[model samples]
Target: MNQETKQIFSLRKFKTGTHSALLAKYGIVLATTAALMGAGAVSADEVTTPQTQPTTEVVAPATDQTSANVGTPAQEQSAVTSDIPTSVPADTTQDQAVTAVDNAQTTLKDNVSTAKDTGVVVKEGDTQEVVINNGNAAEKTSEVLTDLNQQDKAVKEATEKQAANQKAYEETSAEHERVVKEGQEHLEQSTAEVYQLIDQAKKTGLLVTETTTDQTPEYKDTKGLTGDELRTDMAENLELYQAAIKAGIALQDKSVADLKAALALYQANQKAYTQGNTALKDAKSSGVAELEGADGRQGQVIDLAKKNDVTIDVKHETVTPNYTDVKGLTGDALLKAINDNIALYTQAVVDSVAKQDGSTKDAQAKLDAYLKLLADYQAGKGTQSGIKWAENTTVEAGTAQRMTGNEPAVSWGNLRTAAADAIQSLDRNQNTDATFDHIFKINGSGTVIIKNTTNGDVTLKISNIQAWTAENTYLAVWGAKDGGIAWGVFATTHGTVTGGAGEGATGGNVGATGAILAMVKSYDYEVSTSNAVSTVTFNDIDNNQTVTLNGLDGAKLVKGRNVTQSGNSYSAGAGDVSQASGGVIDSNGIQFNLADAKTVTFSGSHFLPGYINTSIVAGIFGVASEVPKEPKKPNLEVQNVDVTVPEAPEAPKPISVAVQKATVTAPDAPEAPAPVEVSVHYYKMTTTPEEPTPTPTTPVQKAAVLPETGEAGSILSVIGGVLLSGLGIVGVRKRKED
Candidate 1:
């Protein structure tokens, strides 16, 4: 120690400690108290627990005796040994304190003696180093704690921002997935439908390719394609609809054409069959069962040939016995009547033959000249036999001329004039003779006179008569027709003929007796005596009875009936023509069967009141003309289609996909946390010095190990502050010094 420092330290002990009372002898330790005061986290309210603590319990013995004298300063003084003092005394020399007194004082300063808050108090005996250092420690700890809290706040904000970003990312990602999924599903369904269309087109022969691949990529990606491409895609799906309509039209056309062809074919076959059937039913056959219509009249005779007992219409081979006419003096006999001697002429021959000669060759030649006449006779003759007599009578052969407007028979004068005119056309040979008396009386079958007129010859044969169908015609000058051997001597005589040519001669040449010659050359016929009663029924396919037509010319019809007319002819009514309707027999003398009013019924067609259908009219034409009608078209309903087919491919592709990353703002670096400002306020309930309690709660910063010049700047900054203060103080001091 320096000599003055030793003196100063000695005197500081006595002044700051009661030990200084005894340290009147020695006082060097007192200055060390200031160093102790600067030690740790001691504050104004801190209960400073000294690092070098002394035992306070031992001091309790002293304080208990002090409380016994409670209200006195002298009593508190007694609690401390007389060697200690309450405050430092300024005067006693520091080199004089007793050694034992300094020890006691030092012990009191290091340990807590009472529990009271004094806010920072430094006594001379206190450890200043320790107090100051403790305060510095507390301040440093507070700063460290503040830094930790600020970091924690920053971390919490960063965590919140990360969570929110995560939540948003999850929601956005989910929505994206949903939209993509639904769109994809729609595309897949559309593709399937298109595939069906493709298959249909292929099966219907519309597709170009015949493989399943035609259906692949059926759904059109319609992104950018247009115009023709769009139309093609639509067509692929609906071609079947178009095809159905086309097929319907084709079928209708074909049906109409086929029906037209069928109608034509049926008509041709009907006409050919009718002609063959008619020729079959009109041959004269004996004992033939005749079919009859309701009206009475013998049907046209037919020969039914039997093939295995089944009756069929006979052809030419199915003949029955019939009589036919034969000419006796048709050629040779007529010429002989002209070339013979006059004595040979006979009146009978003259009447019937017009003239006669006793020559056979000339008679035969004349008859042959009139071949047409023979044909007329043969047609109604049935069959001809040997001719016994022949004649060429010159009687009138014309219609009884009508008076017009349906008047009665022609006058007898006209008939006579016609007869005379025909007689003039005879041969003019002198050997022959002919007269009006040649007109033979007719009975039932042919022209015959029972008594002779000139030669007195009875029972004679006659020639054929001439008459036609007329209203008042002479009816062929005979009542009936017959062939075969008839009654009487041969009608070979004209009216009368004197002997001219040969007599009783039978030679190829002319007979000398002309009258005998004419007699021998004539067609043989007979007069009959049967009553010509009409018996009958006609072709009524319903009846199988014969209709015998006698000479019904005079038969009168019943009343209330009329005959209808058709074309150039007249048709019979269902009932007989009657006088009540101003008509007798039918104009053609046909009798109707009035019974049951014979009917011609029809099926679904209606005939006009007085008009008949063609089919019905033709039935009485004794013929049929059944042409077929047009064929009917088939009637059918349209049908719905059922089909399964693949679809066609799409026209153009259309799809787009894109992805981009989210550019999130860095979660705005957690904002700087707000600064901490801890305010320290001080208050007290009461303050008393009686128990001298010391407390320290709030800490202050001071002591820090000086860094190796890193904190020198801060130190220098503190020094500058101190320099500014020191300059002001120096200015005051210099002014005072001045």
Candidate 2:
């Protein structure tokens, strides 16, 4: 191991308890919160598709860990990718998984960077299939047919939409109902009277524009306008016009109300945005995350499904700052308390939440300051209304608003921002709910999903939430009316799962991660001695990347350098792997697939020649699906057209004649058997190859035939046969004479 790696690892050594707790925490937390994975081909985490999709299943009671019954890591790994990517290491699966942590810490920066910048993981899972040439074809086709038929059955799901339907509907319906109810009651009369007054008021030069008048909206009559009209009626009543004509009347009351509401929304947006900016800056300051020096925003994660591509959804979540109670406060103490709480609440989301938790010291400390400020104020430092600052202007712990010569005097804007943060997140129990904007400005915001699957296999859900175009990002989505979770999609990718390791939650007071994360405003910002402020966060550079780790011994971690196996194996550092060519392996020549490599072949040649006969073989290294040839027809056709048949005419029998070889030689060429030419060529027959019938073998009649003896026996037989035949001929002649 290199010296730098050893040093890094020594610094990263975890206490036994911390390591164990972290493992358990992550196992549990990750169970609740999985990576917001690419719906596309992702190796980060496999989609935990449920087996049997639910057939009136009995719910397994909640347990400390999920997937207990599903299988152990052994069973799961065996079923799929086998090993490498998903499971850290066989050793790492032990309690606390220290070795795995060491390995992960080394690769965290690369993994994170990949996820953020490229959304690509470094390690990918391997997917392969080998079709068996057995007799399951018909059965498989039948099963597919059966499944298709079953899909036509419509199942009415009545247990509510069951999941993502939890929140949007109720909120939306309530808002809609309010307008409907208002329309049925005081809509028309109010509309006509208001319009008349507005018109008359306009004639009297009381207002310059029609939009700012007491005009009624189109209802049914646009009943959707009832709520808005009611607010309008409340502000621009004819009574206000009459009051305006009076001697001491303030004629611009209606205008003032309109401006206030608009201003309120604007201020709320502006403050929240400013806090968001500050929180990010502070997070960078706190060393939680960095500017990344990335020039262009991706803005390209889009669904490739549309022409003009209507946006699916854009959402924002603002948190009402959470406050701890401080009973009383005054002067610098009260201001200090407010500022402290604001900083803490903001940091939680900005530093901790966004960066996957941790880093909320500023938020927690602020609450403590609030309590102190309250105590001091209740003891009577400031008046009931407010406290006056000491004329000395000497800066101390909590007295002066300004800290040092480096920091300028606190401006009204700063005071407003800090106060706004405090009030927005003010504790209602403390009768301090008036700071709505202040509390909400420092909380979480923004969520998005990228899915690339477009095979008509999409599942989507967007829950209850208000929509607004902020910073010019657009999203239009379909969602459940009252659901809390919004927007869902399905995507696909091409490669396998890669360098993905589950991460543990940041230590939050609540002790777990949320379904979504937002900016935190709870980190402190102090100018560092080097003129840098609050810069202390760990960033994973490889956004969604796969990491190849070495020395997962918990004894060491190495980065930006190669790893050694026994004698001579090696794996390049994160940057080196991509930059340098070829596969990565340890010194022992063990090339593990961390970056989702399909296969590795160092050097070889093709000597086998019994390959393709006609045309060229287009198949690449692996799957033959790449080769283009004729599609295979499994069962070949066989026909029986060669049936045997006996069909012809019978031949006539001729008189038989016996002739001796030497005794009777046909001197005249046997007279050619003479000119006896057959008039008709008797019968003709044809034969063809066919399965022949087997003849049975037997030991009957003492076995068989002797054709003739030898040369002497043949001579004897010839003479004897000739003599006997001649005698028989003489005897026949004698018999005929008698």
Q: How does candidate 2 score on lDDT? A: 0.22
Q: Write the per-residue lDDT of candidate 1 for residues 144-253, one digit (tens) a residue.
A: 12222222222222333333333333443344345434433443344444444334333433322221211112333323322344334433322322232233323333
- Clashes per candidate (backbone, < 3 Å): 149, 107
lDDT of each: 0.23, 0.22
Q: Each model's TM-score, in the order given?
A: 0.18, 0.12
Model 1 residue-pair collision total = 149
Q: How well is each residue in 1-738 modelled by candidate 2, as lDDT tens digits?
A: 100000000011122333334333333333222211111212222233222111100111112211111233323421111011122211111222323223423343333333323222122212212121112222222221221111111000111111112222233334334543443234333334444544444443342243322222222222222223333442333323223223111223343344344444444444444444454355335432221211011111112112223222212233334543333333244334444555655454453234321112222223322333344455542111111111111111211121122211112123232222211211112112121111111112222221211100111111121111111111111111111111111111122221211111111221112211111111111110111111111011111122222221221222322433332222222222110101112221122212221111111111112211100000001010011122111211111111111111111111121111111111110000111110100111112233444554742231013233322233223443554465456435533443
**What does candidate 2 score on TM?**
0.12
Q: Which stretches of candidate 1 lie over 4 Å from their true place?
A: 1-133, 208-738
RMSD in Å for model 1: 38.2
| Winning candidate number (lDDT) | 1
